[model samples]
Target: MKWLLLSTLAVLLALAIAEGEVWEEDDHEVLIRSERGAKNQECRYAKGAWTECDSKTNQRSRMLTLKKGNATNCEPTKTMQKKCKKACRYEKGAWAECNPQGQMTRTDKIKAGSDSSCEQKREITKKCKTKMAKPTKGKKAARRNRN
Candidate 1:
């Protein structure tokens, strides 16, 4: 008798599956429901190309769209973000006194929290005007003697 009952249940389950009906089992009960409008299937998304990095935010973003035939409960579109590979930042020092070549120079060092790819130090140089001192009286006498 038990064998006959089990075989009947198995046949019913097979028929339910073939008819687009799902069987859900709980601790104390078995439920049968139709697959139409059900949110049982996993969501699927089509990913879009990543956007250019934003310099101010140091981040990049991409769009995710739900693929065709996905469940209605799934979100249609979403956005995702990631940190961008950023260049290093530098802090410039004050310009030094002008040299004999009428040029001034300054140093730049990587600032705190700068990207690791940046160089540690940089040097900059530019032309400058040099100050002149007045000639002494002894220098004038020497010129007179030479003449």
Candidate 2:
């Protein structure tokens, strides 16, 4: 049963990746907050052709979005055929795996030409850690051999 579950997940993940490109992969250890769209789509040249796709907005979301972008302007040629992936969106878009440091790492698989960031995570983590951590006395440690 465990193996079956793992294999199913693996297949779904592969399909998701092939559907589009991952813009950012960040696995961190802190809380994160950001305002972004539910889904991101892009166009790419693959296998001597072009493909237009958008990642799944979240888990439990299926159906790879295609030709939803500026594909009409792109107008790939016959030789530059687009891949009718004949696939579904498994689990795409922003997903995360946090570490033990109370950090929530984020991974984003968005279309190309998209710019997004997690601004609040940085500010919040810094403030929280500063408030909770104890001050250290004595000389600060260095990562080298002092003369």
Candidate 3:
């Protein structure tokens, strides 16, 4: 009886240690905060790229691939995805799309020939270019070192 009790306690201790109080994985932590839905539906956490898994007819599901931005490398389960769509809303403009690849430019850059509105196009192009410019050398170096 004494040996059995001791053995049981030892096993329990080992299990607790194995489970670990703090375990860190280099895996990306993806957080999808849906402004308008259920908690689980509004946010998803996965271990790889986002995969759209939908069975509902006429309903379009998005397979978002997030990198080091707001979203990470995790796919939300089908249920979670459904919840997220209902929750998320376009904060600005008609709609804003964010994916793992990056932001998509809807309007074409100011066309060169056939002159329609060069001034407006040029202004938009300049602003867009500046906004999308890469980080400075120092900031880039820091990012590289983080990995």
Candidate 4:
């Protein structure tokens, strides 16, 4: 029984290989690749550290070096890019005087070398203390006279 089972498993493995199926395990995932060709080469790559986010494009990239593959047919190194969230930088102007609504506003201009997706100009508003009106002396004098 054991011999039969082993032989069946071997046959299945052979069939899977013959169909150009490749299984690979990485740090974060297990992937499979299939190719339809008489001669298929399984390539393995070593992923390098990701590069810093690019301000202009808002993208991060990494390099993949081929570790095991048919060098003649496969590229030795490849670059992969992915979209990234970048913090917007701006040159802020001084806050303007508070308006009658008790709100102060400032202008923020996109800084040079900032991400392209950042807005060209932004208006920021904040609450401020509203000026209080002083009591009129005439009203106080009339109240005293009435008393």
Q: State the C-alpha lDDT per candidate.
A: 0.70, 0.34, 0.38, 0.73
For candidate 4, the 10 contiguous residues with the lowest summed lDDT are 29-38
Q: How badly does each model clash, as a count of residue pairs?
A: 0, 5, 3, 0
In model 2, which regions exceed 4 Å deviation? 21-147
Q: What pairs collide in candidate 2?
A: 29-103, 30-103, 30-104, 63-89, 64-89
List the candidates ranked by TM-score, beginning with the highest. Answer: 4, 1, 2, 3
| C-alpha positional error of residue 95 in candidate 3 after TM-score superposition, expressed in Å | 87
Overall local distance difference test of candidate 3: 0.38
Which pairs in model 1 have colliding backbones? none
What digit string (tens of lDDT, one per residue) describes model 4 on residues 30-140?
A: 233456342455556778888988778979998878776787865677665767867689998899999888899999998899877789999999999766887666787
The segments of candidate 4 whose C-alpha lies over 4 angstroms from its true place after superposition are: 1-83, 130-147
* Residues 12-116 of candidate 2: C-alpha lDDT, one tens digit per residue: 556545644322212321111111222333332222212343334222211222323356533242121222332322223343444466464443344433334
Cα deviation of 60 in candidate 3 (Å)? 45
Residues 1-147 of candidate 1: C-alpha lDDT, one tens digit per residue: 999868966876787678776544334333334564465553445667789888789899977666643455555776657678767788999999998898999999999988766789989999996567766667779989899
- lDDT of candidate model 2 versus the reference: 0.34
Q: For all the candidates, what are their Cα RMSDs to the real structure?
A: 26.3, 19.9, 23.9, 17.5
Name the Cα RMSD for model 4.
17.5
- Residue ranges of candidate 1 with Cα displaced over 4 Å: 1-86, 129-147
Error (Å) of candidate 2 at residue 74 is 19
